[model samples]
Target chain A: MTAPIRKLRVATTSLAGCFGCHMSFLDIDERILKLVELVEFDRSPITDIKQCGPCDLGLIEGGVCNAENVHVLREFRKQCKILVALGACAVNGGLPAQRNRLDLRDILEEVYVTEDGLARGSKIPNDPELPLLLDKVRPIHEVVRIDYFLPGCPPPADAIWKFLTDLIAGRTPVLGHGLLHYD
Target chain B: MKTSNSEVSAQANARGARAKAARPAEANNVFTIDGREIPFEPGQTVMQAALTAGVFVPHLCYHPEFRPHGSCKLCTMKVNGRPTTSCTLPAAPGMEVENNTTEINDKRRLLIQMLLVEGNHFCPSCEKSGNCKLQALGYALGVMSPHFTLFYPVRPVDASHPEMLLDFNRCILCELCIRASAEVDKKNVFALSGRGLKKHLIVNAESGRLADTDFAPTDKAAEVCPVGVILRKRRGFAVPIGKRTYDLKPINEQADRFKPLTPLPKEEF
Candidate 1:
């Protein structure tokens, strides 16, 4: 008999986001059992892996707002054969990029020094563990090539399901007017 | 030469022909837009006519109730082989109009980009996300993102209306509110006071708030925003995602439901 087929390796991550997209992905619910039969998790939050190892697909959530975000996105691009921007944050910088209009210096000062409700000893929280913020937040595609984009704030669970199923079946996921929405 | 009866009649006819030639071309109420015949009433612009005929011409500022401002330039169409704004261009019988062409749509995409960059349109966070006409048009046009560099202009939000909020950052300057306030509401509570990039909408009060004016929440201007600029307070996200207007049906299909009449006999434009 011929050798058994290998399961597709899938990875996911959230950078500079509230993990809402990841939550939406989990919203796929009971389908996760069916998904396990076709694919294996690699460096996803679900897998709790430190690094992605030759993944077939990667779903990226959030924009590149900090150095760590850029690093993680570039790594996903390098490791995964197909990369999909999972939500509005990864597609157009989303709400996080609103800070791009404001002065970064002023934002830092307002939170760290000038704000009245801050903890008494709170500073800018400078530490080696923290990643440096970029002057402007940018969509993940600007930093790396994205194979696909899902345009909802956090795309509905059905939309994500359709995209994943299409990709798994080796078909291009073409979002109709009903499927694609910015809001 | 002796004047005869036939000669006298011919002289009078010649004078009549000259006067007719001097006058403008007779009005033709029929027109063809994209190979489809559209019948328009007198005084209707091409945009209005197309809308009445169930043809969706992508536009921003050309509301039916308001006078055509022609500022958005999104409804630019080729009328009689000449580029013109359909919102302001009156429909003429026998006119050949091309509204859905690659060239015109490309220009419209550029105009949409300019509007996005010139303002801070963060649709994901805006309360008017689903029902916002600008966002729907952007989706319909397949504008993946604001192609140009993000201008991210800083503007203030006026929350002093008590019942309404004025977020100038989302304003596309469609002048719908200005016209509604003046023509429909009869309050003349709004005006545009700047030029070029500095151009912006202003309330008719020294305090720069809607509450100061006689403007009420029930005014036509309050409900006329095609974008997320003028929003009712305390009603944010009243409709959840997936159940929103554009979410259930796309803009094109939504427009198709607004057709005014049934099938009519084809007529020449």
Candidate 2:
């Protein structure tokens, strides 16, 4: 018998996205068993590993919207040989980047201070626990060199499977017709 | 159209008169796009002929009913080894055109990317996500990402209209609305002003609000927007995402403009 194939270590994380992409990734359903045979998980929510040890593939969802996101993305990029921006958020800033047009302070003020339902003397949060928000919500590629971009609201599970299979087989991933939808 | 190619040459080859005489009358008015013979009328451009032939040459701002604006360069194709806009370039017999090639589509992707980043195209949030032509073209042409730094150009939202909304953030500057308003509606209610970087659409009224003008929801201009700019108020997400135009069929296949009309017939030439 031939030698058993080595499982590729794949890592995934979300930055500013709604976690819809992560949900879509799980939409692979029973394919998870097949995927496990091809790739092992590292630092992904699926594995619950807090830190990423040198990984073969890193699939990151969402845009870089804060200081913590930048650190996580850069660290993840350093560990992975190939990094894929997972969805519309990570690829082109997505819905979170809609706030890019407004001044950050004004938005904060509108939300925390002048809003109707706020409690008396409510103000912007300055908790040391919270990650500092970036002035503009930006695509992750702005902070790190991305190897591949898979774009969609939450790229359909079928598209994700196709991309992952292509990568697993050591071929260039191609999201074909009806696969690269934004919504 | 090149000014040098006069009417006589346009109808029948001025330089290839002998070759033209050898062919049948119906066969004389034909050109090849991607090496496939595509016939054309005297005044028809490569775009019209290709559309008439049921061939899809990806385009924006070249509506069948209106004059070819050629403003949006999405339909740029190689005409005789030179880059030329197909929408305005008058079709001439035997002129080779290269369209739907990897090279052309790649350039078109870059063009689409530029259009995406130049404005704030947050497709997920935009009301026109699935229905928008720009977004559809992005999908159809395989634009993996915006690929450029987002300009996030600040533009006004004209919610002044009771029945409509003008979200300038998504405008690709195709000016189809302007043409539709002026030519078909007979109401020059919209006009584009300013220069590059500053270029934007303006309402014709002194108040500069869409409601100040008599633009109705039924007007052609109201329906001509290829993007999310001109929208009907309170109609957001009405069609659902996956069922909208370009969602049901890829824009290239839906372009049905190619469903064959025998190149305008020889007599119309």
When just chain B is superposed on the true chain B, each candidate scores a TM-score of 0.82, 0.85
| lDDT, model 2, position B36 | 62
lDDT per residue as tens, model 1, B112-169? 8788778888777888888888888777776655655566677878888788889998
Candidate 2 local lDDT, residue B233: 88
**How does each model score on lDDT?**
0.78, 0.82
Residue pairs clashing, model 1: B28-B93, B93-B269, B94-B269
Docking class of 1: incorrect
List, residue by residue over A1-183, the lDDT tens digit for candidate 1. 121288889999998777999998989999888888889999989989989889999999998999989988989999999998888888778889889878999999998989999888787878999999999998787788888878787887877887888788776675566666676
Q: Model 2: how far is B268 from its true place, Å?
A: 16
Off by over 4 Å in 2: A1-4, B1-27, B258-269
